[model samples]
Target: MRKRLSAQIAARRKQQVPADLKGMDASLMAMLDAQIGDLEQRIKGVIEQEAASAAKARLLLSIPGIGPVSAAMLIAEMPELGRMTSGEAAAMTGLAPIPHDSGAMRGKRAIAGGRRALRHVLFQAALAAASHNPVLKPVAQALKIHGKPHKLVIVAIARRLVTIANAILKTGIPWQPQPDS
Candidate 1:
């Protein structure tokens, strides 16, 4: 029992530090800080690469939430959006739930296809849109009413956002989220 008690004490000591800053030694912290700086520079490079890829994507920056990298990833990955209908584009990104029907029975809504990375970037944009754009927050709130999972509702909005973004890119016009009327 004493041995177990000592082990527990040592474990608690380790857990006292926050996970993000668990280690000792100033030199280790310095090295981590330098690496973080380098990573920031690399992220900057990726953002620039995205900006240079398409003027349409660059226009996405006009929207509050989308940055160069997110816009670029959307543009590069969602090429069909430029050619397909808004709904089709959204479905392709796996934002729309696949309807499963049966005789007098129905399963819950589920997002199929692991276009998860695209979904994540778009969701970020949606979050920004909901917070800043006068139009989207109400829509998000309305969607929240059905007792749907918060993430699914966000995913739905994110899909709608991509549809809106597609039009902006194709028409060479600035994005304007639909005003809540």
Candidate 2:
């Protein structure tokens, strides 16, 4: 609803709209902003209410590209994170590239199924990781250098992010930078 309203506001700006329409849009935007803030606060409160969840949240937050929202999403949406293998984690989030093949016919690999909402959250995290994560930044850059499409690069980064998150959770360790090679 907020995104739709934002689009409506943008479209309104392109026209000579009435003053009342402008005022309505402003009011709706303000209301939506307040609700979003409240929701975020509620999510934080829920995470902190459980000792185990709080610990998991801390571990997730230690990752460079994952912020509070992403951590919350992971904790809430993907409860099986720590118990699974890295490939299983990626597959659960729909970041795993599935193969398409048959008798004498091979096709491109694509990701499918799993928790769609969690996948979007991971994609957003991957976008941040591509820019800021010490380990992932070089991988993203190298993919770009090789002329991979932007979506492909981001998907790759997202897969890696889930794998790292899974490993960290499984081991109960905060993310630590690798030593210089």
Candidate 3:
């Protein structure tokens, strides 16, 4: 919606529209942004209001790339986070790779099922982690160095992120980089 509004504003400008008409999209975009900010704040407040959720949110936020929004989404969408195993957590978010195989033929793997919105949020988190996370950074780089496609790399990172989140929540431990082996 924001991108479409931006495009509309650009198109209107290109067409040399009247000043008032030109301002409509910009005003609407500003309104949208403000509303989004308000909603995010409300989400944060709700998460903090609950003891269990606040703890989970804190653990999630401890991860390098998970911000308040991502933590809220995970807590809300996947309440089973701490109880599930790494593979279960990944599968719950649709970040797990599903194998496609046939008699004597192995097809490519792909992710499917699980919470769609959560999967998208996790992907965004993984993208950030791929860039800024100490542990995940090397894993992402190695995949790229090995010729993995960008989306594939991000999916793999997302899967790992879920696994890490699960372990952290289960053990009630905040994320900490492990020593190099």
Most lDDT-accurate candidate = 2
Candidate 3 residue-wise lDDT, 25-123, digit = tens: 667657666766777778889888999999999899999988886788899889988898898898889988899999999999899999998998888
User: Measured by C-alpha RMSD in angstroms, how accurate is candidate 3?
Assistant: 3.5
Total backbone clashes of candidate 3, pairs 3 or more residues apart or in separate chains: 0
Model 1: per-residue Cα lDDT at residue 136: 66
Q: What TM-score number comes out for model 1?
A: 0.68
Candidate 1 residue-wise lDDT, 17-123, digit = tens: 66566556344545555665565466556656764444665667776667755676676677656667887778877887787878888877777774667877787
Worst 10 residues of 3 by lDDT: 1-10
Best by TM-score: 2
Taken over the whole model, the C-alpha lDDT of each candidate is 0.68, 0.90, 0.87
Q: Which portions of model 3 show Cα errors greater than 4 Å? A: 1-20
TM-scores of the models, in the given order? Answer: 0.68, 0.90, 0.87
Q: What total of clashing residue pairs does each candidate reach?
A: 0, 0, 0
Q: Taking the tens digit of each residue's C-alpha lDDT, what string does model 2 give over 10-106? A: 6755777587688886786677667777778888999999999999999999999999988998998899899999889999999999999998899
Q: Please report, as a residue range, the 10-residue window in candidate 1 with the lowest summed lDDT.
A: 1-10
